[model samples]
Target: MVWLFAIATGLIVANLYYAQTLIGPISRATGLDPGAAGLIVTLTQIGYCLGLLFIVPLGDLLENRRLIVTALLTTAVALLAASMTSSAHLFLFAALCIGLGSVAAQIVVPFAAHLSRPETRGKTVGKVMSGLLMGIMLARPVASLVADAFSWHAIFVLSAATTAALALLLRARLPQRQPAGGMHYFELLGSMWQLLKTTPVLRRRAAYQACMFGAFSLFWTCVSLELTGPYFHISQTGVAIFALVGVAGAIASPIAGHRADQGKSRSTTAIALTLGAAAFAMPLLIHSSRLVDLGVLVLTSVVLDMGVSANLVTGQRAIFALPAEIRSRLNGLYMALFFMGGALGSSLGGWMFAAHGWTGVLWTGLCFPLIALCVFATE
Candidate 1:
């Protein structure tokens, strides 16, 4: 069941990222302005935040299996809509729906935690999260490769087909688990504010992950653009290779979870914060040779990915241990906060890259993790 949940997460979440590597090509095809292309990713995240806020809370009000399967089906329809759209207006709207539908992945993560035993909950969440992070890390490279082979539209076509199949499998296999809460839908949404106001741990953890994710979004959003620029002059295939190399960071997910189970989340989070800051700093130090700079970028990619992935699993493990009945809402609130940061990072990344190039991006990315570290210090 754990492995199944993890694979499901990887597949479903991949929908959110298929657009990242394809941004350049998609922008060119649609005649979108280079300065505005980052919105392809940013708008999707904005839509995701919308889902997290409005739709995800319904997890506490509806049956888990039905809610999740329904979300997946919506994703399939949205992906198809995206693939068929020629105008930027239509594609961007479809992208938003894709992000909204992808929140099913969040619903599933908390469901996985609810099904596991208390002692192994961290480990369980870790393994499932490994799938989620892997989905995120792998999505770019896979999208790049697929888009290069066919057209950018082919990426979503493939995703839509695979997602439809997954929905069917989940419907047949996933066990039913409904939240015991009899709270009305509006009341369930209302309670998230109370949860946020009262839960200090939730606030701190969300802030840390929000900062880490902001850095994550900024780097990934801009890196594909950077690689396509004059220095590297890489094609989509070449950028895919860079994304594949970052998969090394996914290994940190389970390790972080194991440590969290041992009650080491605090120290683990500190290490993650430091590593994230150092990742941005490394690129600044490698200006002498292009070869050296690329190597440094690769190293930074792994280090930063490891930091973000570890901190995310650690945060989820802590939050899931809170209360089973409200687990879905808690998960929604936590993810919504960080993803809002991600939307900000993506918007800034595009604008900064357009205005000041990689120098601007590096310094700005550093600030997110540094801010996270400062916030953590107060805790």
Candidate 2:
């Protein structure tokens, strides 16, 4: 059952990312200005933030199985709409809806947390989040490979089909969960602020994850462009292979969760932040042969990804240990802040890569974790 939740997470979250690797081609095909192309990723994340703010709170007010199914169905429709649209304006609109509906993935995470025993909660969230992290890591290569084999549109078409089918499987399999009372929707949204103001732990953990995720987004948003540029001169298929190798980082997810269960999240978080900051600096120190450069890039991806994945699970495990009744809203608040940083990172990545090239991108990515570490130091 946990594994199924994990698989569902990976599939649902993949919708938000298929556009990242295809940004160049999609922008060109749609006649968007190259300078503004990062908006493709940014707008999707903004849409996700919107959903996290509005729809995710309903998880606490509705039946979990039905809420999850509805969100997935919306995603399937959005994916289909995106695949068919020719106009850039219409496609961007569809992209927004895709992000909005993909909050189903966020809903599932808290639902998994709700289902687990307190004794095993960290392990369960960690295992489920491994799937989420896998989705994040694999979405890039899958997008590139599909775009290479057919068209970028085909990726959305396939996603639409798969999402629709998955909705049915989940509807049949997931246990029913309805929060105890009938809370008004507006009241639920209103209470998030109080929760935020009162809960210092939530604020700190969300901030830490936000900074790490910002770095994660910044690196990924520029990596495909970096690979295709003069440095490595790689094709989409080659980029796919690089992404495949980075999947090794997912191993850190469960391990980080175990550490959290052992009451070691604070130390784990410190290690994660340090590793994340160092991952970006590695390439600068390795000015050598193309072979060594390529090897260094691979190492950077693994180390950066490992740090990001570990921090994510650690932060989530910390937050999920809070009040069970508000698990959905807590997760929403945490992820909404996290992805806001991601949106900023994506926008900055596009602009930085255009203005200053790979050096700009690396320095900006490195700073994210360093800033987060400073923030974590106050704790």
- The C-alpha RMSD in Å for every predicted model, in order, reads 0.7, 0.9
TM-score of each: 0.99, 0.99
**lDDT (Cα, tens digit) per residue for candidate 2, span 251-346:** 999999999999999999999999899899998777999889989999999998999999999989988998888888888999999999999999
Candidate 1 — which residues are off by over 4 angstroms?
Answer: none
Candidate 2: clashing pairs of residues: none
Model 1 C-alpha lDDT versus the unseen true structure: 0.93
Residue-by-residue lDDT tens digits, candidate 1, 1-379: 8999999999998899899878888888887898999999999999899999888888888998999999999999999999988889889999999999999999999889988999999999999999999999999999999888999999899999999999999999999987787888889989999999999989999999999999999999999989989998999999999999998999999999999999999999999999999999999876868888899999999999999999999999999989888888889999999999999998899999999999999999999999999999998
Q: Rate the local accuracy (lDDT) of all candidates.
A: 0.93, 0.92
lDDT: worst 10-residue window of model 2: 174-183
Error of 2 at 190 (Å): 0.3
Candidate 1: which pairs clash?
Answer: none
Which candidate comes out best when scored by lDDT?
1
RMSD value for candidate 1: 0.7
